[model samples]
Target: MKAVRIHQYGSIDNAALEEIPAPKLGLDEVLVQVEAASINPLDTKLISGDMKDYFPLTMPYTVGTDLSGTVVEAGLLAARWKQGDRVIARLEPGSSLNKHRGGAFAEFVVVPAQLLTTAPTKLDLATSAGLPTAAGTAWQALFETAHLKPGQTVLVHAGAGGVGSFAVQLAKYIGAHVISTASAANADLVHSLGADQVIDYRTEDFSVALRDVDVVLDTVGGETLSKSYQVLKPGGFLISIVMPPDQEQAEAHDITATFFGHRSHAARLDLISGLCDAGKLRVIVDRTFHLSDMQDGLAHSASRRARGKILLRPAV
Candidate 1:
């Protein structure tokens, strides 16, 4: 199998595509023939070895986390899936997150049944590959974490970002008023994703433009998430995806604050599949790179200015 591996953790230049033996499925895992995969910030974090605190990888590590693929083989325990089924999964622990596992950057990957879900057939497999991490994170934050309600107001940081694009659509689907921050170039992009208001973060200060937001989904941490606490209603909540919110400050403002580390729940992925099929959810792909061009893809993701999800086509 041809796969991208981290010959070293220092930089993207250290990643290489090499031939390695194909992965064998465990009793409860499915072997997927990789069609496409997507790049996420976590991939970069793993490449730089920054997530070593929670997820320590061995010296050699394959680097993909989310992928859209076909079921080439299924374990006996994975009775629900069959060969030839198209799927998308957050290969939880199947990447650098766990030292023992390889990843979807390869020609094939074996992932646990728990993390597998049917891909949205409405979109191409390459685009569907972008959903697991970014879209799932947004879904977890907006509904499971924040519980955004209809007619309420939400301020999403980096609205044109990977998670932000999904957040805006999910918030609007919940019937909440959506306000998102992005560069002026992406205002229309966020609006098309269902955001009711778009604030040019580069040119406008969001805290100065809005007030009493019912929920704020903060994707960017530090100053942006800190300032977000001020614009929420007394009892509103702030859900930060990147880091933990300041509880003391949240209390002072009479609001709730929490952090999110997204999980790949079977139910959540099922729900996302339905939304995408019904056209209520859309996967946003800013760019795509071939499996051989993974280094370039990683560089683009690390650039911190991607308009939406960055993708990798395994078949290319």
Candidate 2:
């Protein structure tokens, strides 16, 4: 099987498509023939060694986490899944650290059976590959962590990007009044995704323009995160997926603040899959690249301008 891998954690340039042996199945794992995988900012960070402290990788690590595929075989104790079952899974990086296991960016991957979820019935498998990390993170932040409610207002920064796009749609699907920041070029796209108000980050200051928001989902940290504290109503919630929120600032603002690392939840992905089947959610694909074109895919993701998810299909 061919896989995109990094021999060492340093630069994405170090990633190359190479022929590698197929992974062996474990007693509690299933072997999946990958149809499509999505490149995430986290994947790039992992390859670049930026997250080595939290997710130490053994050398020659395959690159990717989120994938949708068909099951080819199951291990002794993993009979819940069977041959030809369509599945979506997020291989948690923390779970595989130091194990030297290959990831989703390959023609075949071994996944712990417990992590697998049925793919969306209505969406194509290739597109569903974009859901696990991006959609799951947004779902976790808004509903699981913050418990955002109907009629509440939430501000989502970088509304056109992967997590941001899903955040906007999910927030709106639950009847929250959604506000988002994006370039003017993406204003229409953000609004179409259900953002009630789209702030032009390039030309407008969100802090000065909006106030008394019920929740702020900060995808862009640092200055944007600092200013987000100002927009939230007193006692409101601020969830930052990018970095840790400032504790002192949260105290002064009289609001709850937290930074959460996204974890893969089969239940959450199940719900997201239902939403897709119901036509209540969608994946906005920025581009699709073959496994052989991984360098270009990584570069596009690193550029941080992709409108939504960047997908990778295994080379035939």
Evaluate all candidate structures by whole-model CA lDDT and list the values in order.
Answer: 0.86, 0.93
lDDT per residue, candidate 2, 1-316, as tens digits? 9998888878788999999889988888899999999999999899989999988888889999999999999999988999999999999888752144438999999998878999998999999999999999999999999999999999999999999999999999999999999999999999999999999988999999999999999998989999999999999999999999999999999999999999888888999999999999999999999999999999999999999999999953
The local distance difference test score of model 2 is: 0.93
Report, for all candidates in order, the number of backbone clashes. Answer: 0, 0
Backbone clash pairs in model 2 (N, Cα, C under 3 Å; residues 3+ apart or in different chains), count: 0
Q: What is the per-residue lDDT of model 1 for residues 1-316, given as tens digits with 9 covering 90 to 100?
A: 8999996777888889999998877888889998889888888888887887767777788888888999998889998999999999887653443234438788888888878899888887778888888888998998888888899999989988899989999999989999999999999999998888899987889999899899999888999988998999999999999999998999999999999688767678878988999989988888989889999999998998898898887676
TM-score of 1: 0.96
Predicted structure with the largest TM-score when compared to the true one:
2
Stretches off by above 4 angstroms in model 2 are: 96-102
Error (Å) of candidate 1 at residue 242 is 1.2
Query: lDDT, candidate 2, residue 154?
Result: 96
Compute the lDDT of residue 286 as modeled in candidate 1.
Answer: 87
Instruction: Estimate TM-scores for all models.
Output: 0.96, 0.98
